[model samples]
Target: MNSKLIKELPDLVRNNVISQEVATTIEAYYQSQQANSPNRLFTVFGVLGSLLVGLGIILILAHNWDNFSRTVKTGFAFLPLIIGQLVVAFSILKHKSKTWKEASGTFLFFTIGSSIALVSQIYNIPGDLSAYVLTWVLLSAPLIYLLKSNVLAILHLIFITFYAYEIGYGHYYSNETPWLYLVLLGIAIPHYIQLLKHRTNDNITSLFNWLYPLSVTIVLGTFVKDLSELGFLMYVLLFSVFYNLGKMPFFDTQKLRKNGYLIFGSLGIVVLMLIMSFDSFWYIEELVFFAQESYISILLFFVNGVILGLAYYKKWLQSFNVFQYVFILLSLLYLGGLNLPVLGTVIINILILALGITTIKIGADKVHFGILNYGLFIITALVVCRFFDTNMSFVIRGLLFVGVGLSFFLTNYIMLKKQSSKAKTL
Candidate 1:
């Protein structure tokens, strides 16, 4: 029970709602439950302490490092790694301690990177940032498995994505083959899977939730160079994959941020559709042709279709989500290309308005303020966007804005009144 309910127990006992013995038993049970809960603060501090100590050691060693000879410098570079390895090994073998495991794992992870940097700096290695990051990620990838460390896994995932982005877009401006990052990414997936399997609701699991989607988002843009116009299709299909994953049992239980795939996927599709609704996207001058890489987009579409089909078959997709169906209409609009730009824009605008109304109705029925406000925000944004377009008359735009504002106030007022009435009845 919560604090309010617990506090009310004494009053109930005093009124003879239950005996003193029963009240005592209930209090004792809850106290035991509280005692058994994990200490998250301790874990946070332990991880922070480990990072600070590791950085401190590196800073301390860097003081007057020019005085050391070649052999001495090499030995110094490896010293932290050796120490970190020993600490991690001891944590694994000698104790059943999460703090020790996390601390040592974090230290070792950084130490490995530091060792590589020191060696590179000592020898004047010739490579770009991408190469450096790839090496660091490769070195640290093993720590995830060795220490069963989610922190290291998450860090490695981030680094590998950085490597991919830097190699693909940052270095040389037009690097064609950045596929090695996918191999590196594949190595990190097993650790994430293991974390999910073992401690599905742990803080680390939550971190993985954010990290995986972020990694995908980071690497997603790199495909545009080769795929060209088909990149948009790839993105739509990728978002569909994320949406399907969000409907999975694991992600379904998570909060909005933790369910990054679903949130990003849904919002991504909506935003893309909205952007595509404009005249610029449908203009004849902006026409796009099929590229060889467009086949990849087709493959992704098929994959997305299979996943959505399975979801429908399994009844996982209950009601129509505005995001889910917008893509089909978007694909149709894309097929229309420059021929029916005006019609396409009209259809998309109507679709957005219809979607906003549908979302508001669903939210009101469910009594969900967040969903209701989300719908209102969409309508407000659509109206605001039209303000920039000179094609629409000022008087019509003003009316649109006024209508949206009134709807917001009226919908919220009615919902509030209903909620108040229900509370009074209760």
Candidate 2:
């Protein structure tokens, strides 16, 4: 219930459906109900104040650190940490409000990181930013659970992702493998699961949507060298996993940007299919097989196998996902030894067309203009691509472009008409 809803109540009263006295009572009731919810503005300002104070202290220390002796620098390094710790303790023991916990936890999270950095600088510790991030994230992870803070949870995800990029993906030199990143990623899962269980629509839920797909994207290349050309197959399956995961009840309802898996998966599938549509990719010299087995290749093969196994187990065919079935068909095409390359090209083209049509049908069912346009864009892109890829007559290409233009116009017109009809009914 909201005051926003009560604005419409005046219309009912004017039409003699209700009296002003009834409307006022209803508005008062809704206001009272809303007052019981947590104050978002208070929480936001609390968190912001904590961040500003923490950063301000860091800036102050950094500005004067060069003039300070070792003894003083060491004291300053621990000072913020001790203060942050005291604030957190006070929140736990006395305040215990959500606002206090969030503010204290965020302050301490930054303080601990700053302390670690300053102490390392003071001691001239030998480590890169990757190791520093790893240490900071490990120390800060407990804040997410102890304070039950979504902000800390998101911070953990962001830092760990940077750590993965730095160490796991060879952005920085580290003895650790990418597998360590995966293990570290697990630390945030419990907190994420808690959010999902209790606060499904909470803003923090959107961070998980972006973080997981981003993690996969960062790590996907770690095993690419091993799979070689067959890596494309693994990517296809991985994207399929993302797409299917997006289809789950929670993510399906989210906005497109918030539903990272769906957006990335759909675009990845389309792009990969387009690449495969070219005869050149199929006949590439690097398209070697398991002639030389590597751990990365073995891991990728296992992952793809698991995805296919799960899809078949759950019978995902009923969902009408073109890529899911086409993946299998494409693999078969590759294995059947019709190695002329054009065979793969032909299958891919057909698959893309079918996928485009299916996407349009799905958009029609959902009555979502963005999705409808997305499907239409896919088809239009295909035709445009083929205009260059194929040697069709100029007149035929012109006709195809004109036809696609008309299709776009007609679909949009129809959508507008349907929307108007619905508005009239309402």
Q: Whose lDDT is greatest here?
A: 2
lDDT of 2 by residue, 135-212 (tens): 898888888888888778878877877777776566533445556677778988888887778877666677677777
User: TM-score for all predictions?
Assistant: 0.88, 0.85
Cα lDDT tens digits for candidate 1, 103-184: 7888888888899889988898877777788788888787888877666777788788877787677855684556787799
**Which parts of model 2 have CA positions greater than 4 angstroms off?**
12-33, 171-176, 226-228, 253-258, 285-319, 330-339, 421-426
Q: Model 1, stretches more than 4 Å misplaced?
A: 1-38, 194-203, 248-250, 284-293, 422-426
Give the worst 10-residue stretch by lDDT in candidate 1: 284-293
Candidate-wise lDDT, in order? 0.77, 0.78
* Position 388, candidate 1: lDDT: 80
